[model samples]
Target: MESLLDISKAEKKNKLYDSITPNRFKRTIIKDWQLYVLCAPVIIYFLIFEFGPMYGVQLAFKDFIIGKGIWGSPWVGFKHFERFFTSYQFNIILRNTLVLSIYSLAAGFPFPVILAIMLNNIRGERFKKIVQTTTYAPHFISVVVFCGMINIFLSPSTGIVNFFIKQLRLEPIFFMGKASMFSHIFVWSDIWQNTGWAAIVYIAALSGINPELYEAAKIDGANKLKSIWHVDLPGIMPTIITLLIMRIGKILSLGFQKAYLLQTPLNIDASEIIATYTYKVGLLDAQYSYSTAIGLFNTVVNILLLIMANQLSKKFNDVSLW
Candidate 1:
């Protein structure tokens, strides 16, 4: 009976080996060794810099005494969140962040698509590259330098904008100093700076579309505009929808550098956003616990927004990040 049982176990082991991959995971690694080697550095970087610090996230709910350390700090539960939620400036900060993001999104979204579509229609290669280069140049400028240029160009005393207004016999208005004008300037400037680069992806999508559709449309008596309406728009709609979902996911995370650089006593109300507020609270005031809590809240909201946006995209267009 013992000999028969040993034979049975040997047969089962052989069957298992036969059913699986020849060398299992080892074979895969050996076959794609170069690809794995290439990806190793990125995985290491994320593990070290991106995910390693997650251990300290608990400080958000702790008193965070430097001497006591994050683990030894006293847990205070939702105290910090309660403070932020009940603060007088909560609504104001939220409003400012949303308004800037929405304004930029609404204005910035369509311009790239329009630019790509129009550029696709251009038959002259030289003129198209010239236009693309001119638009793309602004995106290379540093945030600090870009903001400084804005200040100089919008200066009421000697700005070219004011020079033209003075030529028209009108008073030189201080554009940057006005709260109401901040959103418009920020949105329009973002559009001008990023439209060309953003259009690159859409243009790539348009290129992948079958040229035969355009020829068919042309043969059916469709004009230039009509051809684009029938062929180009539908072909690139997936890319547009995908990009829009990403934009919506990041709706609240406006860039901190530009907002901080552009901030002033005059435009503070409009320019004050969660990113700048988090910076000031965390680094400047040294309220590490409070700042961490606020940051965690921001991250949670962003995740929720991303999930919601993904769901909506999936529902409408059957495309999603998940």
Candidate 2:
């Protein structure tokens, strides 16, 4: 009986192996030919444009020389990372990155939500359209042009802001040159540029909210603010959570373009961030490997923050990216 059972088990294992074996690629193509065809271009694009370039990440671990190329370079693992960590500029750059990101996240994140709520509450369609159009126009303005306008508008000698200061018997302040004003100017400019554009997504989410919920809240004698707090906010909480998670994921990243464009020599102490640091190192200094290491570090931190935020959101509110 024992011998028979052993033979039977061997046969069963062979049968299972046979059942699992097949021309998997052909079978998959046959099963979802159209879907595969549709995704082929996107898959190919990412493979070429995204994953292909990922090979260069090895530069971060190498003592890269232009003549030697990335693959031919001498291995110097963690040297650049150590240099960046111990450098005198490390704390300054890290502090600027954290403080600016936090300020932007705290101040810029809610403007869109508030704008969406207000715009949704508008009784007049024409008025709402006008407001949205006026607000969104700024988003399309080129960064250089926008910063130029800001400089012109804030110029101490002749600018409108300084003129107002003069009228109020206050000494003229050069807003651009003030380090203390850098984060506020960056955040408010971001809000002004992006608030209305961001509102479109929140407004779309709000539209999907059931009108019956509002009606029920109204019947229960809830005022406009109370109804919004109870019904509208709850309805949009998922959207809010998702956006908040995305915001947290970008907590260390501020786009280099606007900040770089707006940064003056006087404000460089406060405006220098990881992105700008990378740009200067890679582009200006031509220290490709060191810059890549810094970039890789930034990416890892962003990923970690994203995971942490998602976990916290799930535990606290039962809302998560996954």
Candidate 3:
């Protein structure tokens, strides 16, 4: 009888707790109305510009006709997707996109971390600031301007790079015209442009690490490299993993502007990526449905990659975006 009464009391307490949760939530909303009001614009902006546009994604599956409208357009049931898969350019575009994205990730990801660590270890504040400014200045250069600079520097006739080659009694190579050199130029230039800006986040993470850990490592006779290997890396590991996952998720979404700007007839074989292909087919050729299908396919691949990366990270490191 006593046991039954205790169980009943526990059930009653749970019921009472559930009943009061809504009232508590309502009270919190009333108290925090100003905070919600401040966030309203951002919420409204996303709803209007982001979520609102998703309604048209159905064009990917339909024979989209401007006169007929999205709802009235006849559903084609994967016809565009099939056409894209069987197209001759499919393999080339996919290969170029993956190769460029992977190359960029592999070449560019570590530089920022290495830079942040080096900057954090600097003893002189003045030298650090100067180095930081010099490194970060490239990131502010406009993409178009950067591409123009690349063209100027790599020009066989009047370029500084070819000037050195001529001085060495060698033929001046047309760097921008070589299909083999496109990926290298794109990746290295991107690294140079973005490394310092990317390092800022790691620097912020390093700052938030507890100073006592470093002190303790020193007490244990750990040197600079050892401390960094142990305390510094481990402290900022979650940030690193999060960023890595994000990068992997965007493995196919190479920037269209840079690739398109850098593209030439000679380099087109290696530089014609999915983004440029989509633009040509969508706007240039006026194949709206086809382009939409390609875009949807790209999005689906990204989503899958994101989920896989998140899952793998969670399994190995117990860190995940979800």
Candidate 4:
């Protein structure tokens, strides 16, 4: 009886151990060893560069002294946040960031999709390649050079834009100094420079669509436009949703460099976004803690917006980032 009980207990222990052991990790390693090797460098890069600096986020909660460092700094629980909320410029900055992001999202989001659709529909490969190359060339132009070109072209004196206005017998619009024109210039320039490059992913997705679907549509006497609408768009909807999620994720993170370069004294009111505000507080004014708090706030808002957009998209379209 004791020997039989011992055997039963041992069998139960073995079964428990087996149940707790994970198989997915072992299977993943066996199936994807080569892929894992390729990803090792990227993992190391993120570890060294991205995750390495996450500790500095503590600066957001402290009154950081130059000599004291992050750990030695005195904690000022939410003081900076309070100041940020109460400051007169807070609303202005918030409004500017939202307005610019919304406008850019509305106008710029569909451009790459349209461009990809058009490029895919081009039956002549040579003409399509030429068009693609021409559109993509602008992406290689450095932002400094691009902004300079914008400034020169919009210059009231001897600029091509002004010259055109002169021909039309209308006043040359001042693009740089005008607060009203700042957002327009920023959004339009962003579209022109990025639309082609962004379309590359969509075009790649479109290529993966099965040829049989198009053939079937042809048999049914469906036209090119109809085939594209029914087959190609549906095939690439997943990629579209994924990219849209990413775009929404970065809605608040407008890079400071271009806006800073493009900024003029007259346009300051309209041009001041969260990123620029952080730059001014941190780099220019040496208020590191304050800037860190502001940066954290901006990040949280962006994340919330991304989550909300994803949830809404999932509910309506049955597509989401998750």
Candidate 5:
């Protein structure tokens, strides 16, 4: 009872102290003003390039006449949004977008983790560095160049990939031209390009694990596999959860350039994602308000998914983006 009284008194004291003082956060910021000054450019960049443009999001609801301008534009409420929702292309585009996103997420998410674990297990540092360099190099390739390379490498008539198929007594397949092959090609290529880069954080997390934990495991007679299962995974699971939440937040916002570049008349049925559709309608057809509405809808879904994922993570594992 005395210990409980002492705890209550301590809490009251802390509350009194907090109430009498300015915010600790503000004080810390003021104390670290120089660091904040150095961070000013990044803050300003986001304020300008990221949040600044949000003012025009109202254009999604307004009839954005060139002459009238954004401020002068007349509001149409949900006219554009309703139009997009009720359009013939709505279901098709949404399905294609969701399918591609989910497919890519399922296939691409785990390979990096597996790669990181494998790479961590490697004893030879030189070979590991070489593997990391080779895997990470493709991520630096420009979208246009990467798409071009995909086209050339997967070409039925001239590509080396098809040559291997011919060697197995199979027909030379026109992979880029086939609708069925579109998702496979897109997902696999994305995995290949990003796995190494994505594993970097996991590798860092693994590196940060306390050596004493491994020593303990060894003292317990735990084998290498058991040590990894018991120590390594739990250490990096936070990173995995955080990254998963972020990726969930971007589930709909697939790269427009790669999908657009990969698209062909033959594969349009499968490759017509929301981004490409938005591009065609917004820029090419000059339906700005309608496309903006669609984009806003996509963003709203992402926000909701992010919240849901964060909540679930926190509830189940005490890990979340928040």
Candidate 6:
């Protein structure tokens, strides 16, 4: 009898909790209605522009005839993917993309952090602002304009770079025309263009760090370098790791614009990346299904990399996107 009564009481309590939940939810909605209204446009934008086009990903699996709509098209499964994998250009494209992306990441990743730290240590406000403005101005230049500037500046006969070489009696080199020079030019130019803008995030992170930590480090007889090493680095490590993980996740996603603009017949071996190839095949060559499969593969790889990086970050540093 006691057991029966306990069971009946438990059921009644559960029933009461369930009955209260909807009322509580309704009250919350009433209180937060304005916040929800503010969020509605962003939510709607993502649903329409981002999530809506996901339906077209089906083109990757189908032969995709325009006459036969998406649902009407017959599926070829992994045929296009297999063809891409087996193609002769596969190795070359993948190699060039990986090399450029990895080189860019390795060369460009630390400069922003270094810049931010250096700027943080600056004692003169006026001088610091001048340096910041000088560095940041390049980021505002359009990519096409930047590429044009590169071409003009690197021209063998007429460019300033070659003018210096001529003074030294050395042969003028075509920087953009050489396959080996392509990665260097791309990486260094990008670093010069974007480092200051990228450092803003790190600078913001550094600003949020407690000033008392620096004082404590000085009290402990630590010098400026030691203080930075002990306090500044540890304080901003989470930001660094988060950014690093994001960069790693996009290992294969090199920008097509600058690469395409800088590409010449001589440097095509080093510059034909996945993005440019996809654009050519998909839009220019009219191989819609094939290009879709390549894009899907690229996306799938990026997603896997993101998951892997997140997991590794969580395990090692206890910081992750999740």
Measured by lDDT, the strongest candidate is 3
Mark the regions of model 5 whose C-alpha exceeds 4 Å error after superposition: 1-48
Give stretches of model 3 more than 4 Å off. Answer: 1-44
Candidate 5 C-alpha lDDT tens digits along 1-322: 9999999999988867775566865676688899999999999999999998899899999999999998899999999999999998999889989999999999999998889989988799999999999998889999999999999999999999999999999999999999999999999989878899998988999999999999999999999999989998998999999999898988989879999999999999999999999999999999989989999999999899899999999999899776
- Report the lDDT tens digits of candidate 2 across residue range 280-306: 999999999999999999999999999
Looking at model 2, residue 220 earns an lDDT score of: 96
What is candidate 3's TM-score against the reference? 0.88
> Distance from true position, residue 110, model 4, in Å?
1.1
For model 6, give the RMSD to the true fold.
6.0
Local distance difference test scores for all models: 0.90, 0.90, 0.94, 0.90, 0.92, 0.92
TM-score of 6: 0.89
Assess the local accuracy of residue 36 in candidate 3 as a C-alpha lDDT between 0 and 100: 100
Worst 10 residues of 1 by lDDT: 18-27
On residues 206-226, what C-alpha lDDT tens digit does candidate 1 reach at each position?
A: 999899999999999999999
List candidate 6 segments past 4 Å from native.
Answer: 1-44
**2 or 3: which has the higher TM-score?**
2
Spell out the clash pairs found in candidate 1: none
Model 5 scores a C-alpha lDDT of 0.92
Q: Is candidate 2 or candidate 4 better by TM-score?
A: 2
How many clashing pairs per prediction, in order? 0, 0, 0, 0, 0, 0
lDDT of 3 by residue, 2-86 (tens): 9999999999888668657988668768988999999999999999999987888899999989899988999999999999999
Worst 10 residues of 5 by lDDT: 19-28
Measured against the true structure, the TM-scores of the candidates, in listed sequence, are 0.89, 0.89, 0.88, 0.84, 0.86, 0.89
Candidate 4, residue 212: Cα displacement in angstroms equals: 2.2
Give the Cα error of residue 141 in candidate 1, in Å. 0.9
* Model 2 ranges off by over 4 Å: 1-21, 30-41
Better of 5 and 6 by TM-score: 6
